[model samples]
Target: MSDLWLFSFMDDELREKIKIQSEQTKAVVYSKRTCLRHNFLIATSKSYTENSILAYVDNTEMRSAVKDIQVYHMGTDILVKWQINEVPCKSDTFRVQLLDYKYQQFAETQAKDTSTVLFNNTSPEGIYHVRISWDVYSTVRNLYTHAVGLENVNHGVPAVPHVTDLGNARARVRWTTNPHCTPDLIHVHFREPSSIGLLKVIPGTDETTVITGMKQCIQYAIQLGFSYTTGKEYLSDPAYMTFLSDGTFHNAPKLSFDQNGSLLVQWLLRPGCIVNQTVVTVETNDQPAKEYNVTGDQPLARLNDLEPCAFHTVYVTIQYKNGNVERTNSSEIHSFTKEIGLTKIKTYIVDDVLLAHWESTQNCQALGYRVDLMNPTTGQTKAYLTGEMKYRVSIGECVKSCQLLVSAISVDTMVPVTTLIDVRPERVPAQPRPPFVRRDGPALFVWWTEPNLDLTIQSYKLFVNDSKKMIRDFEVKQPRRSILLNNIEENVVYSLNLRAINESGESQPSLSVQYKWNG
Candidate 1:
């Protein structure tokens, strides 16, 4: 008792090439397995407002540019808005034949995305939507206003954008501005789902970005059409086929970037349909990724040794003549502050000291080694200036020292280290534990005697009163260290001391401890 077959019906040379009156044409009944057959739209115009007949105009005569819906007009009098997928073979009423550019003959009905933005042209000059066939001739006209109803707005304000800051090659975006859009026309579209076609654009507003890639999974989107202003995206539309990354649906392609923290993604291709031998038709879902001129124009590429702040994603793909391919992705996620200023190197206590940078296991962790010798006696290891830094180390006499080796890169991972500079100097650390006066309560219970540690000791420096303004600190990572100065505003008596560090420096202070809180 269930066969299902209902086409709503509309035929008669497509209803005399429909130029008005679809006789209250309406459709909103789907269950025949959801419906959407080859899609169609024909009736070209209709409006009344004061009582009945609200809107109409149908299109998708189908020619293939992907997202078909071109040049429709209406200053006032026919407000259009279309959406009909398979319903007229006999009666659901859907037909078209609207024209105006001198070929004349206008007014069909049922079509939309907010049609009729303006065009009853009394004189203000502007109104068009020509396209026909069925003895009507004309086929293309465009004017419609309010900037063409903004096409329905968002004109392309960076569509399908998403960027909670994804990293390891790049991806970042946030959008919602494009209605006749200016300040940087837009046209950005990316793909990675049965790929082929559009996949890049941001030449303006730059919108806090980062979209380079090692690839994990992708399919992007953005398209309205832009070519001026700050972000210079060319022009192309199919609603911008979006898929920012993550998981996706298809609103216009929504997958917008996301990957910071443990940073991931390493893509090549995979979705479906790939027959490369019989003539190479490998469209693993549209296309986006696989076009590397390597460095044709080259702006940046080679963050050597990598690992200072960590996090990266770089890409550059360009190909065109007819085959069409354009790409540009770079993601460091911006947060690279390292400009304190001052860099003057001169080392004679050693030979050939060359340190280069540009690595991406997320910025190569600081990049180490610094040596300045001459001044040591003990076991020849009394040290003058030295720093190893991994877990920690910086034996010093202080002529100046900094052992860099930062971190951020994650996937296409990397880590290479070499620290060798022996200006000959070592050993001379071991002298702590002299102050330990406990009085507790009204405050004054300082203690010290901890040293001979093995790395990781961020704090433990307490020098009070002497115009040093009174200081205190502690983060010994471990060990039961102590420091309690409490309510001491008394006819006071303070002069506490203690110093000890093991990341290689600091240790000379532990002989003063005079406590007297005679309130």
Candidate 2:
């Protein structure tokens, strides 16, 4: 009755035994008419005869090939789905293989369901081949699908852009392209330092582009984007860079004279600029111009061993490594004449005040004169500026001689003609008014009205007497009309005295004042 029974003609006993075994094992066999024409049979029992015909049925006859396989792209991922007209069993598993255009397997996955998702992380911008297979009865049968193109997938944002060959007014920008999708056009966006919120666009087919007409020493932000013909676009993050201009010597050197009468020259170095060398020329009216070479890194230069009384002109020139040369724009010709000591310097004292007079040489026009007097005994010095040739100064008491410095400044050259003199005054100044004293806690504040005089009062002296009859003296310098004595005894009455001193001698002591500390 069954296909297994058809083999009974070779052995009747075997047939009966198989019938009894089939009944006991609860097994049912399909006849030739019931099985599909392409089916193959497989033996399930091991005890069957070796010569017994065991038909092996291929699993393809029971399993159905996957049909209508479709692939769709969602963002950066690829979704695959298929249908099975007939399933051999509910527990059957399906294997899906993704291949590139070159027929090389790119991705393979197994799923128990009908649909799965794949990523395009490694695949390029082209069509892909999809093969899906299922196992039935230990045999695998696959289904081939049409090519799935990823041309319309969104590539998201591109890579950050980079700047190269940055110059004063030009720069080059480049970016990376997406391997999964090709763009119809690429656009570069940039913003200048002064033009925030305003973007400039450059369209090109290549990944690299050059931008021009940029400002020097300014920072710029650049970004790139890819656009498709279907109006989809993706923008990348911004990249920042600064542009540096060529070096130019635009600042002039400043000139001054130090205390030793040496000429000092200083200049500033501009940003993003380099200097190769500098040439300094000194020209005097009676001598030929002298040149000095200096390195670019050195910003200061000193000129020494020059005549003190001659007028000199200074010129500076700068040369860059790029074969560019520039001169000081502000007329590098500057006049520098050293100070010539004063002529016919004389000094005399009258009424404790010292009078000094001098005359400048006839060769130069004078702008003014400055006289400085120093008391060697007190190590104190004073200076006075006047347009006239005469100056009156004050010397303190018990001072026998003072050092004087008289300088006549030239109006055109600004050089001082200086002289040193020593003199002693014979007169003394009048006494000053008594000081008004006040006590605040343990401190004593003394105030006085300065004496009206034609000459300068160099200093003042304040004498204090405590309750114990101990005396202390303090000297007050010029420009200060008051003095405060701290650490005085509280609730004690203290006596104070004030006197004025000048270049000639000290004045008579003023009337005394007393104050009591209340705290």
Candidate 3:
């Protein structure tokens, strides 16, 4: 028979041998054995409440203690068996590299009761595996699975675009996003030319990478993609790096200070590459002696008036890989002399909002101003004292004759950004006139001409009196650009009127049209 035997709670020396931390805690006890090969097995009888199984060590020289390794679920009471494979007689390192075996399960009948079964066994191919099964009512388990542990695994693919360029001598070397990227952690690695190459690390989601002062023949490649063609050599490796290209371009961008104190600049970069003003270089437009490095946030090489005509300009060049330099320049935008007198407001209908925009005429270009718009009915302030930035207002309606003011930079020399003024109803258009025609019959439709403007004449309004006691009015959708209002009532005498609508208010009624029922 098997050398192991099963036992239950009794009043032998067992109580003194096993230690329990609490009443609900399990007792752990082990007996030393020095036989050919020996082991310990402890299990529960039925469904035990605080269920736990412990592996006992009898052979002291073996690596056996595993802490907090829970082996069985408390849901079902399981009896587990322990076994020791043939002890390795070699070095400790060879013993530590030991592998695990597997087992299997089958339906086992004890008596009239049918229950579950579990065991450690082997397949026909001799690989180890475990199995678990349950019968009708009574199931027993010799639960010690010899499941084999994993032996092989590997890491994921690395990132992209190893080689890059930044322009006046910089290259934008962009790569793929790290899979381990988090809100605070962006994991990327780079190498420069020395043994370490020119390694630099930048954080955040901005994808394009820039390499500056790149040597002419120094090749650079990154670990990305499966097939990268490096001349005659075919690269099937994803992280292959190479330093050769078919051709190169030297078209550095050209930007100069414009009359508006803005940089008139241009350059060519690889499509989808990004550029940012993290580094800045400045040179004066007329004087070569006036040159220096300007901070990214600071404007202009030096501050002065007049040779400047209101602003300053500094030339900058960005360099890319393949030894190309693209030039773009920095612009110092100065305030303009105000020539703004009358501000023109036009309404544009968009998909979901209304927009009010204006264009500066003559000298108002570099100058700034404030625009105030309010509700006519509520007299509540909407947009007040803003910059000369033109944009569509979130506020949908428009009002007439509002207060607006502007302080000219030519006059004040103090306000760089502008002031207000007041405009009235006389500045806007009169309401549209209603259409007129005597209806000779139902099919006899006549067209009336109206001014082509941005005025609201939603539709035609017709008034008729069938008797002295009852007067009826009909409102129909306005006519198409063709001018005639169609589908009107036949043989009816109509007294027509018109009105214009805006945010301020509707215009007064126009001259009426008298129609006689000739039908």
Scored by lDDT, the top model is 2
Displacement of residue 296 (Cα, Å) in model 1 is 18
After superposition, candidate 3 runs with Cα above 4 Å error:
1-265, 269-358, 361-436, 440-482, 490-510, 516-519
Model 3, 1-519: lDDT tens digits are 112222222212122222233333453444432321222323343222224353332222343211111111111221111233344311111001112243333222121121212212211232322222212111211212232432211112223455544334455555554332211222333333443333434445475555455434344443322111111111112332322222254434354545444444443444432333322344444554343333433223332222423344444554344343445534454334434444345444332233445644235443444445555556765543435545444333334434432332334552322334333444333656665554434533444456766554554444444323345545555554223444455455556555544443344566677665553
Q: Over 4 Å off in model 2, which ranges?
A: 1-140, 143-160, 165-170, 176-187, 191-207, 212-218, 225-237, 242-492, 501-519
lDDT of candidate 2 over 108-205, digit per residue (tens): 88867545445555444667677776554343334444445435344545678887745556778877665544455677777765575323344445
- The clash count for each model shown is 112, 20, 54
lDDT score for residue 113 of model 3: 23
Kindly provide the TM-score of model 2 when superposed on the true structure, using C-alpha atoms. 0.35
Clashes of 3: 54
TM-score of each: 0.20, 0.35, 0.24
lDDT of 1: 0.35
Which of candidates 1 and 3 is the stronger one according to lDDT? 3
Give the better candidate number (2 or 3) by lDDT.
Answer: 2
* lDDT digits (tens) for residues 283-394 of candidate 1: 1123333322223332222222222352334343333322234343332332233322222231221111222232222232334333322223322332222223222223
Question: C-alpha displacement of 95 in model 1, angstroms?
Answer: 20
